[model samples]
Target: MKKASLYGTGALLFLALTGCAQQSKSDAAAQLNDQSVMALNWFQQSGEYQALTYQAFTTATYAFDKAQSLTGKPKAVIVDLDETMIDNSAYSAWQVKANKPFEDKSWSRWTHAEQANAVPGAVSFAQYVDSHGGIMFYVSNRDQKDYAATLANLQRLGFPNVNAKTLRLSTTTSNKQARFDAIKNEGYNVVLYVGDNLNDFGAATYHKSNAERRNFVNSNHSLFGTQFIVLPNPLYGDWESGLAPGYNKLTPEQKLKVRADALKAWDGK
Candidate 1:
């Protein structure tokens, strides 16, 4: 290998002559921020996101109409927190700004602060549920350690039923079937289930591979706009988590490679 002389001119010439590929590759890599960051920002900033939520709430109101006709023992609306109820995109944007993958510590810090604003139309929907005899249940996977803060956030945002009976947090598992089943056992027929992730619906959607998740959602064709309302959350969800359910076990670069491999590309010549 040839060596450059120990001078600024020689260093400049060496970089210009032999380092084009290395510099370009690194520059490209360094600029590789997560697309979700932009998606989240867009979701928050764009009128289209407002339109999407308006449509979701429209469907939700229609579902409520059906619920009103049911002569069931009790009825409830099950909703997830985070993106479904609270706009935590700022936290997502924070991670993006720092150019880092998600860190639990920072996420905890954000939750502890309990400053997440309510997602658009969420408060109104919850109020509709409360005003019209529908019990509101928030079944979230937010850590139990953050329970009080989470409750505070919910109360701050004026979400109904921030009490013990309605606020369910994950103490052991992220799979919400048991908790949901408990709701059924308690005799509350879930009229509407809402979340950004399909997993918020039940075990059928939980822990499935990315393809499996899509297939499951497709299989339940009519349920989405009727009994299930989904808020848009491009920041993170089963789309990324379903790809490698054991993602925490992998190294950072390995995780990046897995995401890369998961892409479906057109191989046009």
Candidate 2:
């Protein structure tokens, strides 16, 4: 009877420990979600964010007009869709409100809802490019499954040239070099690239560490406003994943620890 009593107590202890661990993980995930609240507020409510986006698009227009056109190849401008051309912060805000992690299913549903707002000045820039002897290619890493809904959303927002030929979605790889190459191979004189992520410019910064990403930016400092336009996206990005070597695969508690350790805190004098 003592042995059985001891066994029951051990089982109960094991379950109790397991429950604590699960709760700790849940808390960590909640904390991570909470951390995004400030970023979302800035993105959604700040005039600075709108001003920066307008600045990017305005620079992009100038760059497109200044780019020398070839004899045969028509001028083309490559732009990323999400966060660059359209705003999806509502979905991100939903994630925070619901205390949910980003998942493909929820993202797909959001895309299908066709509620994304156009980034400030994005529509005007796109129309300018489309009308002024340039092809605007909407190259994005959004999955192919969301293509139809994405097309509809862009169309609803009055984004020009969003048809099947111009809008390209991810087929196999998220690395967009192949799609970029295909557009070039099709005889378009690619003039400028625009995006929120460095990887949107090319494969150079794809999956790279933050150090490498910064180095690439430093190396190509002159191209910022002219050849590569950038939009602000502090909500979530590969930069978060770049905090640690397998960050995406880490458990919630581990990810929280990684984020904490990555901070460069000052020592009290």
Candidate 3:
């Protein structure tokens, strides 16, 4: 084994004397919760995802009615890509089957294949706005390299306005304020913003803890189904990322313990 010593000390020999051993794992990915399985199953097989998606559009229609009254420029509806417009549960399902967590290589392969299905209401809603002369903009975090496949996937799934100008991808920051601002600057009246993550709507949702995020959501309760139509994506989200103890730096065991610690529940004797 190559030596790894910290603080200019021969810590390898010191650790050997102290009976400390290096950690080893058979697989690069860690075992995840059954919740991951359940979430994917729910998204794929259940009527709940359909109900929620349709509900978002039902509210969006109401928002559209309000948007029509305000006259200035053409209307636009901003939506997220992954779980909001296109269903990625197939990717999650593959992960569960392979017993692996999210890996960029695997995700990129899926994106490259460009066969993702549409979310329940996404196709019809996009068509609805398109027929009415309102444009649809997909503001996603997909890298620029994936644009071709992403565009192909959207077109294959029949999402309207699948083009360079409409697909605003993240190049620098995950914060979507600049994209939103750009749409506004183009003289499009952004009627409704649809996404699974809070960051898709505005800046207030970034880097917040679970409690803080919930509080922020509560503060904007009035916008729930109106100006903001959020789709459900329980398989993965910023919510999981916002959990305590610097999750990215944690070991598998450490991460499991953190998840266990963060759970809120009732104790029954």
TM-score of 2: 0.98
Error of 1 at 267 (Å): 3.7
> What are the TM-scores, per candidate, against the unseen true structure?
0.84, 0.98, 0.87
- Across residues 158-177, which tens digit of lDDT does each residue of candidate 2 receive? 99989999999999999999
Q: Which one wins by lDDT: 2 or 3?
A: 2
Between prediction 1 and prediction 2, which has the larger TM-score?
2
Tens-digit lDDT track for model 1 on 37-153? Answer: 578668779998888887887789779778644566578888999888888888877766776666778888999998899888989989888988888999999988889999999
lDDT of 3 by residue, 107-166 (tens): 999999887999887898899989987899999998888889999999999988889899
Top of the candidates by lDDT: 2
| Order of the predicted models by TM-score, top scorer first | 2, 3, 1
- Model 3, which residues run further than 4 Å from truth? 1-30
Off by over 4 Å in 2: none
Give candidate 1 regions above 4 Å deviation: 1-33, 68-72
- 92 in model 3: Cα distance from truth in Å? 0.9
Evaluate model 1: give its lDDT: 0.82
